[model samples]
Target chain A: MNPMQRVMTAMGQAEPDRVPLFILATMHGARDLGLSIKDYYSRAEHVVEGQLRLREKYRSDCLNPAFYAAVEVEAFGGETIFIEDGPPNAGAPVLRQDADIDRVKVPRLEDCPGLQRGLEAIRQLKAQVGDDIPILGSVISPFSLPIMQMGFEHYLDFLYGQPERFDRLMAVNQAFCVTWANAQLEAGATAIGYADPLASTTLLPRAFYLKTGHRVALDTLPRIRGSVAIHLGSGRGLSLADDFAATGTVAVGVSAQEDLGHWKLAAGKRFALLGNLNGVEMRRWSAEDAEREVKRAIAKAGQGGGFILADNHGEIPWQVPDEVLLAIRDAVERWGHYPLDWKE
Target chain B: MLRGGADVDELSSDLRCALESLERSQVEKVLEAAIRIHSPLEVIEGLIMPALEAVGEDWTAGKVALSQVYMSGRICEDLVGRLLPAVAQERGSFPRCAIAVLCDYHLLGKRIVLSVLRASGFNVLDYGRMEAPALVARVLADQVDILLISVLMLPAALKVREVRAGLDALGSRTRIAVGGAPFLFDPELWREVGADAMGRSAADGEAIVRRWAGEGAP
Candidate 1:
């Protein structure tokens, strides 16, 4: 089967030629092309070239056309600081006060240079790869975007202290999320990776999320034009399996802290699973350790398909060596096939 | 009802319950009642500190959320501010200590650790946010003996080595304690970054400070 076919088969809860690899090597593309992380993410052509090179080098099944999550903050008039060795971080928060919520409006996608770069990258990647590889586009969920807009501590205060203002901000952000997501779909992304780390139970109580982020997600996912994969990054989300399923997401990104087998059982074929590998440790992993982890992951969650092998955090750190990622690729090829040859 | 004669355990439980629910008024009431019964230092050590520690434990157990843990610390920081006049006198003679979010915008971890350390009467200097050079400069300027750093990402966590090397180059005797998501994700990350200690939780910050100060367990 082709790469897209393999991913589609897995999403359909059927065994494919092997488990599809969705390495979240979004930032590592810079290293692939010897471009500064800042410059590589600045232009669509650069991003596409880096992604293609990464895919060609690693032979992974997915191309992440998404840039750093901070780019979404640029829409709110926030600046981003592009580091040399890491993903760009949102600059000074845009929403500093309660009144700023009233002032912050959802900007046109074309107006935001950073977001435009991402959309164009997705379009270019789709033009280049066609339907052979799944190109995933990402948007920070409305609930999570506020973290970049108003900073984490201030955002949490706004969330807990001022309910009405928080709702208004969510309304503004929700509009941007849907618009950005649909635009990505229009740009030729096969699926939208709705990055919502705040929705994870690790960051918020299940009850609180059910009322806030869960409602926002349930409201936002369907508006997107294509399949949506909910990514929680480092956030633990196993307990929210049913909650995620309720959002109509096609897949949920699992954290390394969770048990993959238990997550599969909890998800119950509702959506494809896309992680649980500890990305932080990948930088120091030997080839044998990488192989062992890949085999263990496939053994635990690759039983009946509906699994996309990926790093749990939705990103591979910049420091991870090429050999480590190559080891993961080779290991997946060795141990990711179906028909149950691996032991528990 | 703790105004009359509430025990520390009961007060701590009430405070924890109020904090977990994000009810600042209820938390204030619990604090008021505890303060009425005991000295401010006693209330902080016996009630506020223990309650916040419980909240941290709940967060670790996934029984509570990070927002709850963060807000709980914020609320206690506010309340503890009022009690600082009384608590200040109890500050033990220890090495100069400071904490900062090193090259990371995330401050929730640093905020919680600062609150925990202050509540424990450590008199820690809050370095707000600083890059490695600024942090090293401040450590030297203040002659800080122990430096606690928090970072939420791998890049910032890796920057800890820069902070360590900067201090070492200056011939500073500043010991580094590192915490946050990266350190928690990789147990050896603190060592990899040349930190002297790793705090798994906010409460761990107080223990590290106490150990460095040659003090007994809290």
Candidate 2:
């Protein structure tokens, strides 16, 4: 089967030719293309070129057209700071004070250069790959975008203190998320990677999120077209497995803190499981370590399909050596076959 | 002011529970009662600090959410400012300490660490967000004795080495403590980055500061 067929089969909880590899390489694409991060992410063609080159080199299944997470903030009229070594960061938060909330208006996709590049990349990649490969697009969830908008501490204060304003902000962000995700889908993305780190139980009480962030997600995900994979950066969210599955997402991205087998068991067959590998540690991993991790992950969660091998955090760090990616690729190719027989 | 002769441990436990539940009024009430009977420092060190530490411990264990711990720290910071008397002698007794977010904009960890240090009666300089060279220059200019750096990303975490080398080039004796997601994920990363110590939480940061201050070693 082709890579897209393999991923679709897994998403359907059926055994594919092999477990599909979704190496969540975003900024690393720029690194691989020998372009400065700013230059590489400046145009959709650069991103598409980087993605194609990365897939050809690594032999990964999915193509991620995402530039960086902070680019989502730019759509809200926020500025971004591009760095030499890593992903661009959101500049000074857009909402420093409560008054700034009124100034926030959902931007036209064409006006936002950062998001326009991403959408164009998706369009370009789709035209090229043509469903032979899955193109994953990403968006910052409304509940978590405030971390870049008003800052984490201030956002929490706003969340706990001013309920009405919090609702107002969520409404704005929710609209943006739906609009952005739908635009990516319309641009021919196979799925949307919904990043909502703040909604993770690590950041907020599950009960609190159920009433607040969960509602936003529930209200937003259905409006977007195509598959949605909910990823909570580095949050430990084994307990939130069911909660995430209930959010109308096709899969949930688990963190390094969760065991792959446990997450699979908790999630059951309700949705797919996309990750659990520690990307940070992967930076320092030897080839043997990479192989061992692959075998272990496949052995644990690759039982009845519904598992796409990837890192805990959605993006691979630019600092990770090329050897690590190669090792992971080779390991997955070797050990990621279906109906695997391995001991615990 | 000790209502019904409340035990320190019991009061601290109650405070921790209140903090975990995010009951701001209950936290204030507990602090007020404790402060009436004990000296301000005693109330902070014996009651408020311990309660915050418990919340931090719970957070580390994943038993409580970070929002609770963050809110608890913010609440205590406000109460500490309002309730604690200005003990001039105790205020500047520790080393000249400052906390900065090195090359990253995320300030949650730094804010919590700052609050914990202040509640523990340490005068800490808040440097806000700074890059490596600017941070090094400011530390040198301030003659900072101890520097605490927080970063959310790995690249920013690695910048700690640059800050360390900068300080060494200047022949400065400012000891550095690193904290953040990167260090917490990778043990021995602090030492690898030439930091004197690493803290997993705000409570751990305060303890490191106290230990380093007591040793009087740079």
Candidate 3:
């Protein structure tokens, strides 16, 4: 089966030729290509080239050219500092006072230069390998926007101290997510990858997630065309996995610390689980050790069709040796296959 | 026999309330009321740090969100900023220290560690965030006895190798200690990155540094 079909089949809870792969290879690609992060974030050609080169080396189902989570905030008049090698980070809060909420409007794609560059890259990527593989566009989910605007600390204060204002702020961000996701769909991205690391219990209470984080995702994500994936899906995720699945997300990005089989049982077969591999271990451990981890995760959950092998969080590091990527690729090809009921 | 005969229970309760409210002014007011009867060290070690830790506990256990935790961190930073002048005066001739956050989301841990280091009687120098060269140069120049680094991501944690090599290149023997999310997730990261040791939180980090300093003290 083709890459798209493989992903679609697995996402649909049916058996495919093998479990599809969708590694978050954004920053890693930039570093490997030796492009300044400023250029990688602004130039579609660089992003497209980096992505294609990485894909050439290691086959994957998703082409995420833009993983800079700060673009939407930057477009919304938020301050950001572009580092030489790393992703751009949001500066001080955009909405300084309670009054700034009135000025909070959903930023248009055309208005956001950074996001526009990414969309253009996705369009070009589709034109190049669009038919054979799925191109996934990324957006920082509304729940994750607090870190962008008003900074993370102030964001928590806004969430708890001024509950009503926080709701209004999230409403503004949710609109942007909807508009942004729809535009990516229009731009030839077959899937929308929603990155909401803050939704986990590591940062929020389960009740708060179900009430605010889950609600925002449910209200908007389902409306997008093709597929959707929410990341950092651990931290009390086992209990709330169904709520996340109910958001119509086809894939869940969980950390390696998560029990994959538990997620398989909790979220059921309809959703594909992406990641469980520790990025630190992959970079720190030897090639053989990294491969061992890959095989171990596969052994636990690779049996079922609904699994996409990926790092738990962050893109794979550039410092990782090429042999490491090849080793993981080989493991994916060797062990990440379906028909679990097969007799060895 | 406290400095100003302040009621420890009453001051602790009030200070805790101020920090929970997350307003630096309120925290300042609590400090003002306490300092009349308490020494700066007593208030910081007794009142401010305890409140911040309580809030940190709430944040760690998920009763409070990250934003609240960040606010508590900001408040601690403000309190430390206010107290540093007196702290500097009091801790004369203490061992000099330097700290750098190698990555983001470091404000909380950095502040906590700074306060702890000062409270534990170290002359703390917060270098804030810096590139590799500046980080290495500052450590070498100051002859920083214990260099504490904060890293919040896997990439930054991995980048610790470069830091270790940089220190080696300069032939500086600054003992490096790492803290934050990456090390917390994988303790072996400390040894793997070739740091002198690892610290879990601000106080825990201070304790670790103290142990190392104590062992090294002639």
Candidate 4:
């Protein structure tokens, strides 16, 4: 089967030709294309070229150029610092105080420069790669969206000090998520990656997560235009895996920090499981070690038909030697075939 | 009458409560009450730092969220800023520059580090998360004794090599000391990123800067 077919099959909870690959890729492409990071991320043409080049080089099953979560943050009153060879950082939040949350107006999603660039890139990527390669667009979930409101510090203060205001702020964030997801889908992204780093268990108590995180995913996932895979962070994501799987998402991005054994039991055939690699360590790993890790991940999570191998965390580190990425793919291809041995 | 000495038990409780609640006023009031008896340095090292550790523990234990961590860390940042002028002179002195590194905006780690550095008597140049090129310009211009590069992302830690090159191009002798989540996880990463050394913690970073200040840059 082809790349898209493999991913779709796995997402469908059925076996594919092999284990599908998924990763959050960016800067690696710019380095390959000899393009400035400025143009690579901001300019649609370069962005498309960058993703295409990476897809070709990595031979991954999906194309998701999640450069940074600040795209929509910039749209909603935050500034973004776009460096030449690095992902952009979210700017100082325009909404600093709890009072400011009241006056906050969601910006026109279509007009947001960051989102527009991504849409154009997605369109170009879709046009060139066609349906054979599934192009995914990423968006920050609403639960964590308020972090961009007045910065993380103030948002936390609101979580405790200003309950009513906090509820309103979340409402506004959910609205923007819905609007942005629809826009990306309309623009050509075949699926959405509901990137919610804030909802992870590392940050919140489960009580808070259920009300805010579970609610946001519940409200937003169903509202998405198509199958949306959720990429969460921290071990808390593991605890919430069952919750996420129950959200009707296509998949849950599992981390190496989490036990893939538990995920096999928790998610089961409900949705596909992607990732489980320690991305930072993979970069610094010896080629031999990197392959060992890849083999280990596939052995544990690549069982049955529900696993798409990838790093459990955010984007691939820009500076990780290209050898590491190649080593991972090579190891998976050699050892990731299904309906065979998983005992080792 | 202003308090003349810190009540170890009373001040500890006050500091703990203020931090647990993240009440700026309570923290200030308790800190102010304690400062009359104890040097702000003593208050930070003895009271505030311990409270920060508790909140940090709570965060790591999953009892708190990023907001709590950020707020609690910010409270400490604010504490140092408020207390530094009074107590900074007592600590040994050094000149340094620090940045949160490019592409990562998580600054609580750097903020706490900056505060601890200031408390350690370093006249730090706060170059808030600028792009590497701009940051390189400031570092070269300032000619600091120690360069504290605080990076949370692996890519940002790797970008330190470029900053190291820029400093080298000028034939400058500035020691680069990297800290933050990434380097803390891998002490050897300091060398990987061309940094002269790695700091295990805020207190450890202070020692790294002091040594670099006296010995000059690598």
Candidate 5:
């Protein structure tokens, strides 16, 4: 089957040729190409080249356009503090006061420089490998974007002290995400990868996630044309699987700690589960150990169908060897066929 | 002694009321009640921290959201604002410690530590969020006894090395301490960042700070 057909079939909860391996490329991809992290982030050509090399190496199904998590906030007029070796961080929130919510506006896709740059990268990926791989555009969830604009304190205060204002801020932020997602879809992105890193088990309780994150996700998911993958990057809130799946997300990405069988049970048969591999472990472990762990994850989660093999989260460190990543791909190829019996 | 029992009951009741008020997001009322109580640590550990923990539990159970957690934190801060001066007046001095966020944009951990350290008698100079390594160096130059850095994100935790490198370059003597979710998830991260001590909670941080200061760990 074609890459798009395979991914879409799996996303649609049907059997594919095999379980599609969706590896979210990281700085390790660039390091494999012998490019420095600084050059990889700053230069568009370096980023594209790195991704192309990764796509060629993994022969994976998905292509993510996000290099770092701070892109959306940067586009929304927040300052981005760049470091030599790590992902750029959003500087101190621009909107410190509660009243600044009134002035907060969603950036237009073409007008916002950072979003424009991101969209351009997606467009470039489309031109280069649109047919061979499914391009998934990354967007920060609205629940997190406001925290990026206003500091976490101010944002949380707005939620509790003045819920009405909090709702307004969320509405604007969600609208901003919708606008960006729509633009990415138009730019040839086949799926929208929504990352709410802070919306994890350790950070938020299930009730708060249901009230705030769930509703915002429901609002934002429909805005995109293609499939939506909701990544609760932290492993803390596995109990919210049903809640996450109920938001109409095509797939729910779990962390290294989540049991895929448990998620399938909680989220029901409809929700496809992706991920369980530890990023730190993958970076540090031997190729043989990496293979063993990947095989274990596949055996546990790669049963009937409805699973995508990926890192627990994005941002694989540069120190992880390319051969280790290749071992993961090889293990998936050897063992990830669908409709396998548990007795094996 | 019997009369002293009644006084303890009153203080506990007052502390409970203050905490409950905080959980309800009644910032002003909680602050007022905290002032009404005589034991500041009781107000903090008994009333404030417990309230925050309750909110945290509510968040985990899906009863409350991040908004509620942040709201509870702010309300607690409001109470801290009122209590700070009173504590300063009574204690006559605060410990010499520089408290700041290490790398992540998430500041809840920093705020919690700041409050706990203040309650534990530390004169904290809070540098807020996204603090540069250079700024931390300048603060350390003031001859602070201890430096507390809180991180939440992995990408943010990487910035700790930058702070460490900066401190090394400056040849400063201030002891460095690290804590928060990142450390909980990746314990070796503390050693990687060259922190003098690592803590898992506010109480743990207090103990570690005391031990580092030669006051004996609580």
Candidate 6:
């Protein structure tokens, strides 16, 4: 089966011929494609070409058009600071005070430069690869979008000291998210990958997740025309598995700190599981070592289906050689098939 | 403020009430209380940490949320910042340390570490979050005696190793220590990252730093 079919099969909780390997892009992919970080940010085609090269090099089952998670925030009026070697960082929030929420206005689909560029990339990818590859478009979730606007501390204060205001801000953020997700879907994204990194243990509790995060996910999922995957980057605990599943995401991106077996049981058969390989480890280890680790992760999580192989987190360092990506792809191909012995 | 025949529960309750009062109290009031307390460590670990943990628990139980915890942590951070200069004035000269969340983008853990270190009389430089190794090496170059790294993610822990490697390559003599939820739960990681020590809580971390400094554990 092709990569798209394999990913769709896995998303449906069915067995694919092999685990659908995906490399959530890192700064490294841009460097590998010889595009400077500035070019990657300023030029839309640079980003698309980098994604295409990474897909071709690793033969990944999924194609992610952008490497950075700050795109949507940038589109929402957050100043973006580009570095020579690292991914762009949204500048210190434009809306620092709680009162500034009234000043915050959602951007139109065409007016958002980053989101527009992202949608165009998705359209281009769909035109190039069509249904042959599952193009996944990404957006920062409401919980994190506020973090981009008001700074982490300020947003947290509004959440606690001024909760009614926080709820209103979240409503506005969620509306934009719905709009963005729909635009991406209309532009040819087969799946929506929502990166809600701050919603994890490092910043919020599982209870807060249900109150604020779950609603955002539920509200945005229906707006997208395809399957939705919630990417909760590392930190916190694996308990988010059930929460993400409860949010009605088709897949939950598990970090390296979490055991896939544990999340699988927590999520049950309701949601597919993606990733747990430590990208930093891959950067430092040999291809052989990476292959061994990838094989172990696949064997552990691929047994009963609902598994798509990917890095536990993004922002992959440039030092991780191309050979390691190939090694990971080869390992998934070798060990990802179903109906295997659990004893192995 | 201990009552006659007070048990652990009563003392804990008293401490909790004291903390709640401090949380609501202006920055000056909290600083004054910190100075007035005989055991600043107890005030920090027993009073402040527990209060923050209670907020965290409230967040976990759904009574509160991230906003609440963030606000509480920020308030506590401000109170600690107010108390630091006075505490340092009383303690006289002390060794300096740099506390940070390392490569991760979460600053709450790093803030707690800074508060504990400052309360313990160490001059602390806090580098917030998502700090690269180069920035850390520059801090080490400034002659900070100890480097305290905290991270919530496993990938960020690897950045700790990168920082360690950078220091090693530079032949810097700064002692390295790491703590956070990930390291707290995974003991073997301390040795894996080659940190001089690791601690589970802010109090424990201060104690470890004191022990490593040859001042006897706090």
Task: Output the number of the TM-score-best candidate.
Answer: 2
Q: Candidate 5 at A23: error in angstroms?
A: 2.0
TM-score of each: 0.96, 0.97, 0.82, 0.80, 0.84, 0.81
Clashing pairs in 1: none
Model 1: runs farther than 4 Å from truth? B1-6, B215-218
The predicted structure with the larger TM-score, 2 or 3, is: 2
Clashes of each: 0, 0, 4, 4, 10, 1
Clashing pairs in 6: A201-A236
User: By the TM-score metric, which is better: model 1 or model 3?
Assistant: 1
List model 4 lDDT by residue over B1-218, tens digit each: 22334478788888778776668889888878777777766776677666665665565455665455556666666766766566556654545555455546766567666755554334677877766677778877776767777777776778888888888888878778887656644557778778888865555666666666567444
* Docking quality tier of model 2: medium
In model 6, the Cα lDDT at residue A39 comes to 71
Q: How many pairs of residues in model 1 come into backbone collision?
A: 0
Which lDDT tens digits does candidate 5 get at residues B1-218?
11245655554555445543445334455445555654665555455555555554554344444444444555555557655546545545444667787656678778766665664445678777645565565666666767788887666666777777777777766677887666765668789877778876665666666566666221
Candidate 4 residue pairs in clash (backbone atoms < 3 Å): A201-A236, A203-B65, B4-B37, B5-B37
Per-prediction DockQ, in order? 0.79, 0.78, 0.26, 0.30, 0.33, 0.23
Task: Write model 3 residue lDDT over A276-327, tens digit each, in one string.
Answer: 8776556557767866887777666676577877877746654556677778
Model 2 steric clash pairs: none
Q: Could you tell me which 10 consecutive residues in candidate 6 chain A have the lowest summed lDDT?
A: A312-321
Candidate 1 interface RMSD value: 0.9
Worst 10 residues of 3 chain B by lDDT: B1-10
TM-score for chain A, prediction 4: 0.95
What's model 6's overall lDDT?
0.69
**Candidate rank order under TM-score:** 2, 1, 5, 3, 6, 4
Q: Which ten residues in a row have the lowest lDDT in candidate 1 chain B?
A: B1-10
In angstroms, give how far residue A161 of model 1 lies from its true place.
0.5
